[model samples]
Each structure stands twice: as structure tokens, then as C-alpha cells.
Target: MANYIHVPDEAPAVPKIDVTVDERDYRSGALKLIKELRPSWKPSEVKVKFFTDGITNKLLGCYVGAVMQDVVLVRIYGNKTELLVDRENEVKSFRVLHAHRCAPRLYCTFNNGLCYEFLQGTALEPEHIRSQPVFRLIARQLAKYHAIHAHNGWVPQSDLWLKMGKYFALIPKYLKDPEQNTRLSTEVPSPQCLREELVWLQQSLSVLGSPVVLCHNDLLCKNIIYNQGAGNVKFIDYEYAGYNYQAYDIGNHFNEFAGLNEVDYSHYPDRAFQLQWLSSYLEAYKEHKGQGSEVTDGEVEVLYVQVNRFALASHFFWGLWALIQAKFSTIDFDFLG
Candidate 1:
């Protein structure tokens, strides 16, 4: 087995593009964000470009003033995300994670928007997650993330089951309008089946007695920024970060390893792979949190089973999240798939 090693390098100078925001009404928010971020720069000197990958927010990449200048990510919450997300609590989570460097830095925030220091590097792909070295590095980062507690305020979902129940309850509202979502209406499991499964899952998982820790509920690869230059990964998008079962967090990430948009389950890690990966994560998590004991083989085996079962919760969480987004969000992504 290869040992995961760190070789840190100075983060390269953040590239700066110099261009002007087009004078249009739709451009107002982006322009406003730039002026708020760097009041010294004029609109004509700032370049406002839309980032195309977001599913839950309007992402804008803004370059203010000149090249070599720092970049900031401007996020406008999607149309109805506020109904499901408490921005105030989300902001507090960001502060705690950023303060310790587990997540990105928050430059500024407003009623419905935020300006974040742009993290350099590509988001990890499924292939990258499959790489042993990259996989181990991410495990360490996630372990570090799980150990974080919201120091400035209350963390959401100390009650994970109730939280998911709330999401499941939204199904009716989402399905009410005939046009709520043409595709998802046909794709999502019936409300009855979903509920029964939820109840059973909660009952079954209760036996594990998993620790309740802060989790990045949305562990999609896109939310993870890999900075090869720094020899580590940095988490972004704290909209769903909060307290939840430790097994659920690891399980959710493994589920995401299945990939997005055609979601091939074949890529999901096998038993042997899960054992190796989960063992590394558990050990690294303990080490980072200063637990001196080694994780036992029996414990790793139990966690492997636990995480695989918890993977079902991850599918349901995102499926419901997409249902809500399908009803209201205007972002371009295959929500039903």
C-alpha cells in the first residue's frame, strides 16, 4: 500500500482578468457584488462572467480591475433556496470552516448573495476520486471537515432524521403544481414508499450508534476543489454543512463516487475498495482529531457495512433536493437524473 504524503507548494498567483461588466439590468447584481468587494474599482474595469456548473445557485466569476489581482466568487442563491436553506446559519458555518482553512474564505455576504475568495484548481472528477493518492487525500480533508464544529453559532440538524423528514414532507408541495416537474414526478419514488424506507432506515441505522459530527451534507465532487499545487483539497459550498451522523457523511461521499449525470452505480466502490478507503478515512479522522488509538479491522468492517447502508440516505437527500430545485431553480442541470 502506498503511503499518502504531502508536498506543499506556495499557491500560484491567482490569475486576474481585466474586462468590464456589460451594462445590462441582469448584470446589476454581479456589478453590485464587484463594487461591494472592491469599492476602488469601476464597473467598466471589472469583468463579470457566469460560471456554468452550478445547480443550486447563480455562480459568477468576477475579475475586478486588473490581471494578477485576486479573484472572488459571487453567488446569488437560486430563486427559492432560501425556503430550504437558512442563509444566516450557513454563513456561520462558513466562518468556522474558513477560519480553520477546511473550506473557502468568505469575503462578504448580503441578504441573498455572497462574495467568496475564488479557490484555484479544478474540481475532482470521478476518475480522480478513483485514484488511490487523490482518494486518500480527500479522505483526510473530509475527516478534518467532520471534526469541525460551528464555533460562532448553532449547527443545523443535530436531529438528522427530522431534517430529512422535513425534506420528504416537501414532496407534496413540489408535486402540487401539475408543472412542478414533468420528469421528476414520474421518476421519484412514490411518497408512501419513500416514507416507509425512511422510517426503516432510521430504525436500522440507530443500531450503529454513530457519532454526530459536522458534515458536508452535499459532498459532490464539484463541491470539492483540488489544489494540486498545495497538495490538498479545499471544500466549498457550505449551504448544507451541519451536524449529522459520521457514517452518513462518509456514505454520502462514497455515493457521490458513482458520479453525476448518467450516475453509473458500477463505479461505486466495491467491498474491497470500500474497506481500504473507509479504513484510511477512519484512521486519518482519528489522527487529525488527536485520537491516538489505531482503528481496528473489526471496526473498519462494521463501518464499511454502516456506510453502505447510509448511502441510501444520501440518494434520498439529493433526490429530494433536486425535486425542490426542479420546481423552482433555473439552473441548467438534469435534476431528474
Candidate 2:
């Protein structure tokens, strides 16, 4: 196994993308968007701070100055992310989640980015993810998200392999030449090699019986907010959200336990621990659906194993994504780190 190193909780350094907006522009944009969101709010009174967790978005933290503060996040989508994300679908996901209060309220979406309410909560750390309560909270939220019928009434992308195929096709076009690429280690697999692995993964997971649902395709820890006062968690960053295999969502989430920046694979959850966590998720899922019948251990056990297998898909998805980002993205973070 490749050795994993620990990194600090600091957000990765801002990358060198040729952005259309700057700090002043982001603050100005936030002021404009928020004024539109709350017509009574004066733009002159609005204060915008920089939200640092963003990798692919230029995020400014905006608040209406007051004792009862109304804070919202203004995200300016980075240049070239259009090469990867389906922005229309993302807008749809945010609208639905906003209605349910499971996500930040969508204030407005512009051609370049969007404005949304920023919740009061801390993002769970890598250590926090290993906690049972935190894991269960996220798992149940995933189940609830899976059950939601999009207001837009779109078709489900329950299969991730198809998306993988699409992203893979974009690889050569986006990947920078080897000489220009410094973020990736030499051990990073070639696109052809990664394709072979994805093919095998697709075939291997074809028999899993997990049902399709609308999914938050990307469930990284940084995207989840834990509201202690409400004792609830809300998911953010709908840019990559869509329908996919239920197992893939759970599996991908488990994979995120390692956290970003450090990318510590050693922290990946084990089978028994995974099952315990999954049981809570299934129980909550049944409860959400108003099913009184008990969920069988057998059912939970099956999902546990399948999610582990599906974990391979998560690695490949981001590996391909990082390779493309290394070449195409101008925001200068350590994509390989």
C-alpha cells in the first residue's frame, strides 16, 4: 500500500486559473446577488469575506451586518470547471434541496456562479468522520437525498460507469502535457490503464442489487456541514450532484473518510465498521420512507459489501478528475496531494 501522510486542515492554496473575477469582483458580485435575494437589504451594508474551502469555486462569504446576521455564500464557479460539471443539473439539484432545507437556500444563480444561504455550522474533520454519530448523520442524509424526486423530474443517472465513460473521454483533451504537469506523481496510472480498471469495476459491480436514486454524487467531508444546535447536518456543493448507483454514493462517502489534501487511504473504513455505520443508514432510510417493517441485517450486510466494492469507482473517478484538473485547472492547488 502507498504510504499516506497527514496534512493540516487548511484549504489548499488558490490555484492559478485565469479567472474572470477577482476579490473585488467576487465581493461586488455577492453584494449584487444578495441584494437581489433580499430586496430590503442594502448593498452598502453588506460585507463579503473569502470562504477558503473552495478548490474549484471562487467563494466569498457575504453577511448583512446586524445582530441577527443573515450570512450567505457567493460562489463564483472557476474557469474550465465547465469542462467537467453539468451546471444545469447542478442548478436543478440545488433548487430541490433548497425547497427541502437539506441544502443552503438558493438565492440566485448567474451565468458564472450562484448565491446561497450559508448555514451556521462547522465542517466535520477527518477524525469527525470516524465518529459514529457523524457518519450515521451523513449516511441517513444520503438515504434521504436518494429518495427525493427532483422538482425538475429528470431521468436518473443510476449508473456511474456511463459518467465514467464520458469523463474518461475528456481526459486526453484536458490532461496537460507531462512536462507541464507537476501535481501528479509518476506512479499515477496512464489514462489507458485507468480505463482498463474502470471497465473491470463496471463489470464486477453490475450484479449488485442496489436500487437507483437521486444521489449527491460527490460527498466529500468538506461539503457536509454539522449544525450542532439543530443536531443536523446539511450537504453543500451540488455541482457534482446527480443520480447514480446507491452503492456508489455510500461507497464514495466512505472513501472520503481519508479526507482531501492528505488523501489518507489508511483511514478508509473497514468491513465490520462499515456495516455498523450502514445499518444506521438503512434504518433511517426506512424510517424516512415510513416503513415500519424492520430492515434485515442481511440487507445491511449486502449493501456494506457492495459499497466496499464500489469504493474502487470513487478512486478512479477522482484520479481521472485530478489528472484533468492538473492540466486544465489554473487554480494552483496540489491536486495530487
lDDT of each: 0.73, 0.73
Write candidate 1's Cα lDDT for 70-186 as tens digits: 777777777778867767657766766766677676777755677788888888888888786888888888888876644343443445686778777675444444653554557
TM-score for each model: 0.85, 0.85
Off by over 4 Å in 2: 1-24, 66-68, 149-159, 173-185
For model 2, residues 1-337, the per-residue Cα lDDT tens digits are: 1111111234122112222335445665555666566778778887767777878877877776654357767688776899888877677667666656577766666767766777788887888877857777887788788766533444444547767787888764333456445324365667677778888888888777776677787888888899888888888898877767788888899888888878788899887788878888888788776786378988888888788888888888887787667667768796654
| Candidate 2: residue 97 Cα off by (Å) | 1.9
Scored by lDDT, model 1 comes in at 0.73
Error of 1 at 222 (Å): 0.8
Which 10-residue span in candidate 1 carries the lowest summed lDDT? 1-10
Quote the positional error of residue 124 for candidate 1 in Å: 1.4
